[model samples]
Target: MGLLNRYAETLSELGSFVLPAPLKDMRVGLFNTTLANELALPEHLLQPQTMLDWLHSPVTPLTQQAFAQKYGGHQFGQWNPELGDGRGLLLAEVIDSNAQPHDLHLKGAGPTPYSRHADGRAVLRSTLREYIGAEALHYLGIPSSRSLCLFTSEDTVYRERPETGAMMIRTAPSHIRFGHFEYYFYASQKDKLQRLLDFTIEHHFAECKAATNPYAALLGAVVTRTARLVALWQTHGFVHGVMNTDNMSIHGITFDYGPFAFLDNYEPGAVFNHSDHQGRYAFNQQPGIALWNLNALAHAFSGHCSVDEIKAALSTFEPTFISQYQHLMLSRMGIETNEKEQSLAVMQSWLQILETNNLDYTYCFRQLALADINKAQCPFHDIFVSQENRFKQVTLVDQEKTDAWWESYRKLRLAREEETELLSLNPAVIPRTHLLQQAIELAEKGDFSLSESLLEATSTPYDARWDTHPFSKPPSSSTHTSLSCSS
Candidate 1:
């Protein structure tokens, strides 16, 4: 018997229900089951014995014993009191080998009391994006939800169009959101709010339980983690695209990979989601937006902590984010530096050059990792569209400014001891917006080979040999901005 089955024997068996043939093709595996086996989860969970015998043999209705959670959020900065897990169901929780608890959620299983007049089915395209995106982030060393299984059914789901339906089994340290606290606090449910706070502390922030002001400690931890997470995202050129209050995770993991993109060109104002009219969640604005969301979360804890304490905690975000981002950027640049100002100046200069020249962000940094200062020729300059103009501008700048910086950078690189090591920190390939669009387009036509290959290449993004793949390049002008959120 599987570990899950053995574990399940201890808890009251929740009745099981057939996923319905409509959702079969996309079936993946349970998160804990996959990690427990130390084996890659099968693309689909179709084993009869595992489903029938191990997963509670008989078909049963989903238990409705737990009350659905209610949460309010400032959607695009306007308060909306009616928001919850409208289409999501929390199946159960399981303890992992580390003894940490994880929530197992079945997204698109069915509608709950919170379902607001919409079917709960997820489309295959979105399911695939979430599955691969989450897995990529996890492997990249970013804290994120893990994708256990993806189940596709024959059932058709209607959004803007009729699409094949699917469901995803996602595992997270906690599903509790910033908005969850907002719900109780805004409704003036002090008793319930305190109950939720107590539960959160005991479950997710046990270290803070002994603190005189546990809420303050909790807020500080969240702020610190969130700052680090945003730094990771920025360093990798990832744009979350939609950073609403509800989408922010209390545990600081990156969740909800909706309309996201990796930057091709380093544009500070880059916008990935077509639905975002005001550019509220642009690439450069993410750090500020994260702070805003954290403030919202801090507001929820206002009953237990003073305004000054919360502000102090929130203030840690900028410094923490900058420190983490600088460390990551130095590693990417192959610079070993304890000097913050000098290293930050080099990083900023490179970003400024890339932004000025409209150079591909990933390629520019990857090339700079191999720049040769002695030759009086910077191969890194070749990535720019008009190298002559850029080089001329570089020459006109104070030579001392450039020379001193490069000399310091060279010494820093020598200290690091390996050029390849630094290059490895910056990936040669990313899931570029154009390529993702192509994969989505092909998948919609029932062809998945391109998508599969792209997934394979992105999983091992640092591999230089894979650069020969045509999809690795920025898209032509015709298809660059044509992508839609629906895909």
Candidate 2:
């Protein structure tokens, strides 16, 4: 706990008090001791009792200062002015050996002012999802909040049904969201807005302070980073399921992973969140939705800059996203971006082939790492047929069309020859929803073998051994991949 005071932590100056409601019978079912060690936390602090005491006791030095930061957001493309941290609180910011401060957030601790008539608890099922979900994204070369610890309790909380309660501590560079600025901006609280802006630039966006237009430069920086982050999501087939501005981190990381899913098949328009009946956050719509969120962020800075100036900054989103996406696609194929249009054409054709055949998205790109332009391509074609049987999908591909596609692919590869980089870029395993479900299911039943194994497997997703890890396989028809906001 000494680490908390070591950092140059700037706790919120806002005077809103949102007290934590303690659990009745708090107990830890699982603890991530490995991550704790990585953080250089004292070995004695690894015990469940220490964590439960720190979280459940309101008078602890750390907990006493914890408060729910207020913010507003656009939910599913509609502005909601009354939103904040409903089920969590910022306990403190702990600095590492590198002198970098990271937020130590207590999620699912209890109800706050922002609970808005909800239970303000997370079940063991959903906690597991966040635990592995964050870890998976981290290992995938994506910017994400990493989970530090998780604890389960005796209390049962009701969602669709009564489920055991759990808490998870997530560590991130910062927890600031676009809504944080929007909270003051929309309320016409100009002084508070300036305070928050100054605090943000002084602590997190220090580099922006030297710019001629720090606010505009800060907004532009967020635009570029956010565009690139969403591009990475598209490359890997991730659907965020919810793109509410409140969930969009100003730091450009994949902030909140709720109702999220990887491509089960090659369905670009797939909406994993059943609550998303409108498919607003579908696989293909992520880029556009991210731009929409950035637009909301720019509006938060409206009084500071002209509408035309903001729009000009926003204009960079599309080009930044397009270039990043193209570069990622080319790098994954071991092709250089010598001719952007041609490289994209080949990538598009590859996707078309996979989508047309309903092939496994992760594996299709993965095996391409080992692709050979010289081989007759029989083994490659056989993989798809084998995958069809494994996933219980009927074989369906036009042979003539497939043959033509193969020839085109061969020509593309023969022209631009490269190898090792492709293997590193393509992941052999992902935290498949099916695997997460099984892990959570077994964990809820007092078995953590699967969850622990999955943690290890996903930690090194691009390793060769994962090719046979069983988790590397695609989701079958019976796999429960669909999720909701509750998930």
What lDDT score is found at residue 67 in candidate 2?
Answer: 69
Give the range where candidate 1 is weakest over 10 consecutive residues by summed lDDT.
1-10
Over 1-487, each residue of candidate 2 has an lDDT whose tens digit, in order, gives 4546212234354434555666667666657676666666655666757867776667764587776778899998888988888888777776666766687777886777788888778888888888888888889998888888777767888987888788888888778899888878988888888887887787778999998878887898899999999999999988888989999998889887788888967888888888888989889999999998998899888877777778878999999999888888888876554666776777887798788777888888888886775775534667777766766677566666767777766666677645435768988888888888898888777777898898888888899998877888787662436786883
In order, candidate lDDTs are 0.67, 0.79
Look at candidate 2 and give me any clashing residue pairs: none
Candidates' TM-scores? 0.83, 0.94
TM-score for candidate 1: 0.83
